[model samples]
Target: MCNIVGIYHTLPCCSSLTVSLRCSLLLSLLKVANYSSLDACLNLRWPSAESEILPRHVPKGYFVMQVLRRCPSNTSPLTLQHLKSVWKDVAGDLNVDESLLTDEDFLCCCGSSSPSVNAILGGVVSQEIVRAITGKGAPHGNWYYFNGLQCTTTVEWLPNSAISS
Candidate 1:
């Protein structure tokens, strides 16, 4: 259960230059302006290969996390309009333009609650995203690490609001 802080502590300052560089670049891309946000963002479950400290595909998991956090509720299915609005909020929070994020970008469905083709986030299927976000196959927060270990990561639902930094 190695968190970002834990992993950072495991390595000498000079020994983790690559991790440092990746962190800086990812932090900028994700528009994390503070230390706390960086911690939360890095702690989220991401796709990774063996023993990788960071997620293999960060942006995909990150976008899914943001969407889930912004959702009004977890039980009720999310609507496209609501999803669009949530994306707008996400853009605002990241200080990016609304145009940069659209329902089409994520392939979210419009005017249909029934799940099907084109109903989920574009390339990333809704079920797969949910599974990863809930830590089924991916690493859970503090429950497992990206160090290629066999640990039981818990499957927890997303909170109603975004993770406070």
Candidate 2:
């Protein structure tokens, strides 16, 4: 549960260095975990609800876009192999560990529903993105647990009605 936020004091600006720095920082944070523990590997963070001056003007009504992928947990091994193969074929590189699919960390969430590992991971990444884009909050990632049997959703943070305000 790592929450990270980057703040830009200045306004109306864009720089490759800034983007690169943010990406690198986030990646480093993610890479620190073992990725093996179902509890340890998951990250759940969100942006601040408070308003802050933007480094650059985001066009009015620019809604945040989210991309979601629902991957079957059982096919992770096959998926990893395919991704590695595709990378090798396209880039003529073979740096990825095809066996990682069998790693304990990688296979931690093979069978589960409600608050599935996939959802946890996705939520973590999404929260980080939100924190990076909106510079507010205590930098503590939030968590949610859902029960498939009970069909209940529990949220760590209250939903914000004025996210952009």
Candidate 3:
């Protein structure tokens, strides 16, 4: 919300600015960045009045944060390592490596005999790209899945990593 931010910055004491004004300002900022609407960004809800402002505090070395901090950089080796860790968590320790895997690699454990898996996976990836570029819906950061049985598709998000040269 650039307009809101601008308005806030210019007129910090304007008490009459409504939520709609804030939203409008935010939308303007997104527009300048080539985004169309608020839905293009992740939806985050504010805490309700009844909710505690400070919940149970984390003691700094939380496991989730540790994993996040170790997220692979953009280098192929680092990406592969990240994928290995993800696969270990999801598929339980498959012997995956960087060998032929690119950052864009899409692997399906479905048997080689099943060409359907390839088609489905490709379609799912394409759909995700379309959604991301068109800003039609949420951005699919990295992973995607297609279930031929259910004819359903899902997208997964991955944290951004800083690759050292």
Candidate 4:
């Protein structure tokens, strides 16, 4: 398995350029972690996990998704199509099977390419209103599916007594 902490240390903060870089980085990590026999397309030197800053109570997969989903004010939101295009390019560059990068492997709930008109506003307020009205609506934050599994954005902290039980 690939060391996510090591990969995290090597990544730069989110910006337009950095977002693209991070995309490449994430794909590389996925390639390494998922495929053993395939040679990497990019000759990236992964860093050691010596100076890692861990996120609060998040798994490596969640942390990586957070990093991938970050869209700074200066950058446009990343679309699944763009990600797939990048994957294809990377596969071509690396001489690997493009089929390996499947939609089921990575799912991102980003805005659609075509614009649409909706009655309800979208944000925290919208989500709260929907929840209060219908008891169920959209999820709290951006949705991501990694390794064919979905993850919750929020984490609950159990009391120390509960943990001890």
Stretches of candidate 3 exceeding 4 Å from the true structure? 1-113, 146-155, 159-165
Task: Note the Cα lDDT for every prediction shown.
Answer: 0.42, 0.34, 0.38, 0.38
Among all windows of ten consecutive residues in candidate 1, which has the lowest summed lDDT?
143-152
State the TM-score for model 2: 0.21
Candidate number achieving the greatest TM-score relative to the actual structure: 1
TM-score of each candidate?
0.31, 0.21, 0.29, 0.26
The window of 10 residues in a row where model 4 has the poorest summed lDDT is 156-165
Clashing pairs in 4: none
Which candidate tops lDDT? 1
Better of 1 and 2 by lDDT: 1
lDDT of 4: 0.38
| Per-residue lDDT of model 4, residues 93-146, tens digit only | 434456654564445335332221222123435666666565333323222222
In TM-score terms, candidate 1 sits at 0.31
Instruction: Provide C-alpha RMSD values for all models, in order.
Output: 16.3, 19.6, 15.0, 21.5
lDDT by residue (89-141, candidate 3, tens digit) is 43222112223232333222122336777777777678877875665554443
What lDDT is reached at residue 133 by model 4?
Answer: 65
Candidate 2 regions with alpha-carbon error over 4 angstroms: 1-92, 95-115, 136-165
Model 1: residue 139 alpha-carbon error in angstroms: 13
